[model samples]
Target chain A: EKASQLQTQRDSLSQKLQETELRNTELECQLLDLEQRLENRRLESESFRKSLRSLLELLDGKIFQLTELRDSLAKLMESDSS
Target chain B: EKASQLQTQRDSLSQKLQETELRNTELECQLLDLEQRLENRRLESESFRKSLRSLLELLDGKIFQLTELRDSLAKLMESDSS
Candidate 1:
């Protein structure tokens, strides 16, 4: 009777081991998927940063151009008034 | 003698064909590279547009806040004067 109980305990332990291994494999796969997603996000962020830099530069150029245009307009207005 | 001349002509034609093929391949590669660069530029432009939109919204909000603050200060000054 004790031998049967011991056998049953061993069977349960083996079943638990298999379940644990399966869970570990599932977790590992999930981890890899998450890592891949993170890598993609990093690349996307890098590209976004580069685009932002370019846009800022473009905006600065436009602002400078607008300021020059405004100054020219002001001068023209002053001359007209004079 | 005529056969020898024909053979020489054929060889020249074959060499020209190979050169043309190589040129075509090079042009194809350049075209692909340009297309990829254009795609990257387009994506960059899209992100830049989004960022600019957000920035404009933020600037508008701040401007509205500043206007409100100025109006409140003006009212306070008027009351003090009275």
Candidate 2:
């Protein structure tokens, strides 16, 4: 009877082990998927940052051109008045 | 002797179950941490996109102002020559 009880306990433990292993496998898969998603986000953010930097540079150039043009207009107006 | 052997088998299975449970716990913790990191990345990306959209709007306004200024300068120059 004691041996039968031990056999039952062993069976229960084996079942629990199987369930735990299955759960572990599922968690591992989830981890992999999450990691991939995170990597994609990092890449996307980097690309966005690069594009933003270039756009800022273009704006700077346009602003500088505008300043020069305004100064030229001012000088011409002053001379015309004189 | 057979009962003794069965007891040994049960002990080994129990030990394996304990180990598997421990591994599952670790994997679960890893999953939680990864999920948090991914959420942070998403929020950061959203913020960056918002800033980029505003910057583009600013650039458009500047360009429009520049065009107007250039046109005024051109008209002044043409009238002066005439």
Candidate 3:
């Protein structure tokens, strides 16, 4: 009867061990998936930053061109009066 | 002399015509530049819209992933007790 009890206890311990390993695997997979998603988000954010920078440059160029045109117009008007 | 006065008037008229042509050319150049800039701004705005769409998709995906994780965790806990 004691031997039977020991065998039953051993079986229960092995089953618990297997359950813990399976849980660990599931948690690891979840963690890996989360990491991949986070990396993708980071890359996307970086690309957005680059695009914003380009947009700012374009705006600055447009503003400069507008200012140049205004100055040229002013010069033409002055020449007309002279 | 009357001929001298006529000659002076002709020179003034020709000078005015040249000035008008030059002004027209300058205005045309400015208009073309403005149009090009406007086109560039439109294209940039479209690109920004696309980026915004992509960002929204990324946010939606992340939210979905988080919801899935929450559900999985809840299921895991429920199973553990059972």
* A22-48 per-residue lDDT for model 1 (tens digits): 655565565556556556756887897
For candidate 2, lDDT tens digit of each residue in A1-82?
9889988988998888889999989999998998898888789878877887898798789779968978996898789954
Query: Per-residue lDDT for A56 in model 2?
Result: 78
Q: Residue-wise lDDT of candidate 1 within B1-82, one digit each (tens)?
A: 5455555555555555556556555655655565565567668768877887999899789779968977996898789953
**Residue B7 CA displacement from its true place in model 2, Å:** 1.7
In order, what DockQ does each candidate have? 0.01, 0.79, 0.00
- In candidate 2, what are the lDDT values of residues B3-65, reduced to their tens digit? 898899899998998898898999999999999888887787688678878987986897799
Per-residue CA lDDT of candidate 3, range B1-82, in tens? 5455555555555555556556555655655565565566568758978987897798689779968977996898799963
Error of 1 at B4 (Å): 96
Per-residue lDDT for A1-82 in model 3, tens only?
A: 5555555555555565555556555655655565565566558768978987897798689779968977996898789953
Better candidate by lDDT, 2 or 3: 2
TM-score per candidate, in order? 0.48, 0.83, 0.47
TM-score of chain B of each: 0.85, 0.89, 0.80
RMSD of each: 24.0, 2.6, 47.1
Ranking by lDDT: 2, 1, 3
Interface RMSD for each candidate model?
Answer: 32.6, 0.8, 48.5
**Given candidate 3, what's the lDDT at residue A76?**
84
